[model samples]
Target: MRYQIGPDEPVDVAVVSAVSAAEECAPEALPQLTEAVNPDALNEIFAPKDEGPTRRSGTVSFDYSNSRVTIERNEYLTVEPLDVIPTP
Candidate 1:
C-alpha cells in the first residue's frame, strides 16, 4: 500500500494512518509510532529550514503494525506486509 504525504501533512500522522490502513486496524489500536521512531525528529528531518529549500532526499524504513513502512523524499510512503511469501 502506498500513501502520499501532503505538503503540510505531519509525517507521524501520515505514518500512523498509512500503517493503520495497511493493517486494517484502527489507528488507536496500533502501537505508538514513537516506539519505533521519534516523531519530532522525523518531522524535523523533512521540514524546511528557515524558508530554505524543501527536503530533496532521504528514506526511512521501519516495522510498524505488522508491516514494513517506508518514507521517501518525505513525500512518498509505502507499507508492505511482513508475512508475504514470495512466489517465483
Candidate 2:
C-alpha cells in the first residue's frame, strides 16, 4: 500500500496482510474496503463534531492491491487441516 500525506508531505507505503484466518491455512482474503483516497473528504463527511478535538492538517491517499481469496476444507471435515494457500 502507498500513502501520500500531502502534495508536499511524505509518502508512506507498505504491504498489508489481508488474511483473516492464518491458523486455518487459507489464503488471505483481500480487504473488502481498500484504498482510501482524499481522507480530507472522508474527514469532512465523517469527522467528529465535539469540543476539544485535536486539530491536524494534511491529506492522505492510500493505495492498495487486491488479493485473491481461497477456500480450504478437510476431507473428513474435522477441521484438522486447511488446504488454501496464497501464491505470490
Candidate 3:
C-alpha cells in the first residue's frame, strides 16, 4: 500500500499511518514504529533547500515489524510484507 503525506505532515506520522493501514489495525494498537534512521533527521535532509536545486530523487527503506517501509522523494510511502525465510 502506498500513502502520500499531507502538507506539513511529519514523516513519522505518515509511517505510523501506513503501518496501521497495512496491518488493518488502529495506530495505537500497532507496535512501536522503529526506524533505522532518525525520522527527524530524514525530514531535515529531505526538506526543501533554499540554495541549489531541491532534491528530486531519493529513497529510504527500513524494516519495521513484519513490513518493509519505504519513503520516496515523491512523497510516497509504501509498506509491504517482508519475505519469509523457511528454517532448515
Candidate 4:
C-alpha cells in the first residue's frame, strides 16, 4: 500500500492511516504509533522547514501494525507486510 502525505498533514496521521489500511483495520484500532517510533521526532526530521527549503530526500522505515512502513520525504510513503521488507 502507498500514501502521499500533504505538505501540512501530520506524518503520524498519515502513518496511522496507511498502516491501518495495510492491516485491514480501522485507524483507531491500530496500536499507538509511538510504540513503533517517536512521532514527534519522525515529523521533526521530515517536516517542512520555515527557514529553508522543504526536505525532498530522506527515508524513515520501521515496523507498525505488523507492516513495514517507509516514508520518503515529499515523495511517497509505502507499507507492506513485514516479511516482504528485505532484511537490511
Candidate 5:
C-alpha cells in the first residue's frame, strides 16, 4: 500500500495512517508510534532545513505492525507484509 503525506502534515501521522490501513484497524489500535520510530526525530530529519537545499532524495525504512514501512522524502509512504513466503 502506498500513501501520500500532505505538504503540511506530520510524517508521524502519515505513518500511523498507513499502518492502520494495512492492518485493517484504526490508528489508535496500533502500537505506539514511538515504538516504530521517534516522531520528533523523524520530522526533524525529514523536515526542510534552513540552510542549503532541501533534502528531497532519501528513504527511511522500518518494521511496523508486522509490515515493512518505507517513507520517502518525496512524501510517499509504502507498506508491505514482512513475513511472506513465496510459493514455487
Candidate 6:
C-alpha cells in the first residue's frame, strides 16, 4: 500500500504482522496467536531524498502453516535518464 506524505508531514512508519482468522479467534490460545505474527515481516520502503510521493508496487507471498512471508518483487516509479541536454 502506497500513501503520500506531504512535504511537511510528520509521520512514523511501523512494521507489525500478518494475522489469520483461524488463529486469532481460538479461545484456548491467546499467547500463541500473538506469536504467530511475525514483526520482521513488516518492512518500510522509504523514498530517496530527491524523490517524493513515490509510487511503489509489489507482490507479497505468505504461508500460514510455516509462518513465512516474502516480498516477491516490486517496482518503483521513476523518470528515465536523459541522454543529452537540449540546446536553448
Pick by TM-score: which candidate is best?
5
Q: Write the per-residue lDDT of candidate 3 for residues 1-88, one digit (tens) a residue.
A: 8999877888888888888898788888866765345767767756788999888989988877667888898488899877653336
Give the TM-scores of the predictions, in the order they appear. Answer: 0.87, 0.19, 0.78, 0.87, 0.88, 0.27
Candidate 5 lDDT, 1-88, residue by residue in tens: 8999899988888888888998899888888988878899888878898999889788999888778889998489998877772436
In candidate 6, the residue pairs with backbone N, CA or C atoms under 3 Å apart (3 or more residues apart, or in different chains) clash, namely none
lDDT for predicted candidate 3 compared with the true structure: 0.78
Candidate 3 Cα errors over 4 Å, as ranges: 83-88
Off by over 4 Å in 4: 86-88
Q: For candidate 2, what is the lDDT?
A: 0.28
| Model 6 segments more than 4 A misplaced | 1-18, 22-38, 45-51, 66-88
Q: Return the TM-score for candidate 4, rounded to 2 decimals.
A: 0.87
True-structure lDDT of candidate 5: 0.86
RMSD of 1: 2.6
lDDT of 2 by residue, 30-74 (tens): 343334334345334333347786434433223333322221110
Q: Please give the lDDT score at residue 53 for candidate 5.
A: 85
Question: Alpha-carbon error at 56 in model 5, in Å?
Answer: 1.7
* Consecutive 10-residue window with the lowest summed lDDT within model 3: 30-39
**Clashing residue pairs, backbone N/CA/C < 3 A, model 3:** none
Model 2, backbone clash pairs (residues 3+ apart or across chains), number? 0
Better of 1 and 6 by TM-score: 1
Global Cα RMSD, each model: 2.6, 15.4, 3.1, 1.6, 2.6, 16.1
Question: Ten consecutive residues with minimal summed lDDT in candidate 1?
Answer: 79-88
Candidate 5 stretches greater than 4 Å from native: 85-88
